[model samples]
Target: MRKLGVKAAAAAVILASPAAAEMEYSFYIGSQSAPHSVLSGTIDGTAGTAIDSTVAWEGRSTAPPPYYGMRGVYWRESGWGYGLEFTHAKAYASDADRASLGFDSLEFTDGHNIITANIHRRWKNQWWNGRLTPFVTAGVGVAMPHVDIQHGGGAHTFGYQLTGPAARLGAGVSMAITDRMSAFTEYQFTYSDNKIDLDSGGTLETSLITNALNFGISYSF
Candidate 1:
């Protein structure tokens, strides 16, 4: 009798557990605003002397452009979800401006590929009627940025492949279209700081802030 009671309690526990989890994949295309950084510091001059210079850098902010990104997520019935995401963009300048002495026509170009691990908190039920839900998302990730700096009438240039930490915060409203598909639009803000190592010696630090408005579709499988 005790064995039979234990079996019955086990069955009850299994039935009372949460429902099966779901997985979603999303694709989005949108515009990412420009990012800017300032460069300043002292470098090695002749015979171990340090020369200090002030430099101002303008990245994508010089001219705004469009960017695209995607995500794959897994959700449970408990109103929490986790995912992975990727984003790519470029920052360039057509004309170079120099702020530091002894440098002329300084140009900067950069490309970034970012990957992040994201977490989302969502409402357990549709708040406004049916089919409309709200969620907030945040993530921390790493970015691989390709950097190129040119100066001295294109005679001197430094290029480096760099890696840095990045983070973002976003909120959106999702609407159901069908049983397995949904759509959403979100606004996100991201920040990052990276250091570029010059082959000639020393390092350059860059800081960036970007804003994005993205619209996307998600499919559940």
Candidate 2:
């Protein structure tokens, strides 16, 4: 009964938050970018794999989704923000090419993601755009990255609890379609570290960089 009480209290806090500057249901779709760093481990600077597409679920500084996992929003500086995301991708390598030399002689694929609890502040228009303003944010959170590899009858998966340091330089625009609702789109760049085992049994540490150019629709209450 105590566990249920704790859950109820948390839910009450979320329902009590006022609209405007609160996190609504926000969804995103994009691709995993090259690995970058304040540290190192990126191949050829900040470009690694091709494109591992993904879909993410994000909520603002409100109650988190219970059915999805432990993901929600919080405060950082003076504003509110959250980056609750998860994704998967797949690829195929030729088994007939001369480049197959000593490889598994089959397809190679991987899937990875991170649920970063970043903080953000939304601003009204500054110049003359009327509904657009350049907003900036910076925060840190947990980065749990995972990868899976398959060959013949064997499959390998690597994952861990890592660190996430991120920054957002983007602009947003919104207009009221009704009295209590608005919609917007934002473009951002996100960065994180990668704990990679490019090949089996050979562990390599590096930072994986991701550029998030996003389009989103939200309904505020």
Judging by lDDT against the true structure, name the best candidate: 1
Clashing pairs in 2: 23-60, 35-208, 35-209, 36-209
RMSD of each: 4.5, 12.4
Which 10-residue window in model 1 sums to the lowest lDDT? 42-51
Deviation (Å) of 42 in candidate 2: 15
Task: Specify the poorest-scoring 10-residue window by lDDT in model 2.
Answer: 59-68
Would you list the clashing residue pairs of candidate 1?
none
lDDT (tens digit, per residue) of candidate 1 on 12-107: 879866445678898886666654456543233233223334333333532433466788888877889999987665554324324334444333
Task: Give stretches of model 2 more than 4 Å off.
Answer: 1-23, 30-32, 35-110, 125-130, 150-155, 158-171, 197-200
The 0-to-1 C-alpha lDDT of every candidate, in the order given, reads 0.65, 0.39
Which runs in model 1 stand beyond 4 Å of their true positions? 1-19, 41-66, 93-110, 124-128, 153-160
lDDT string for model 2 (1-221, tens) is 99999999998877655433444444444332332232223222245322222212121111221111122333232355665543221222333431322224221123234455545565544445454434444445444544433323333433343434433344555444454344555555545554554433333344454455444444433
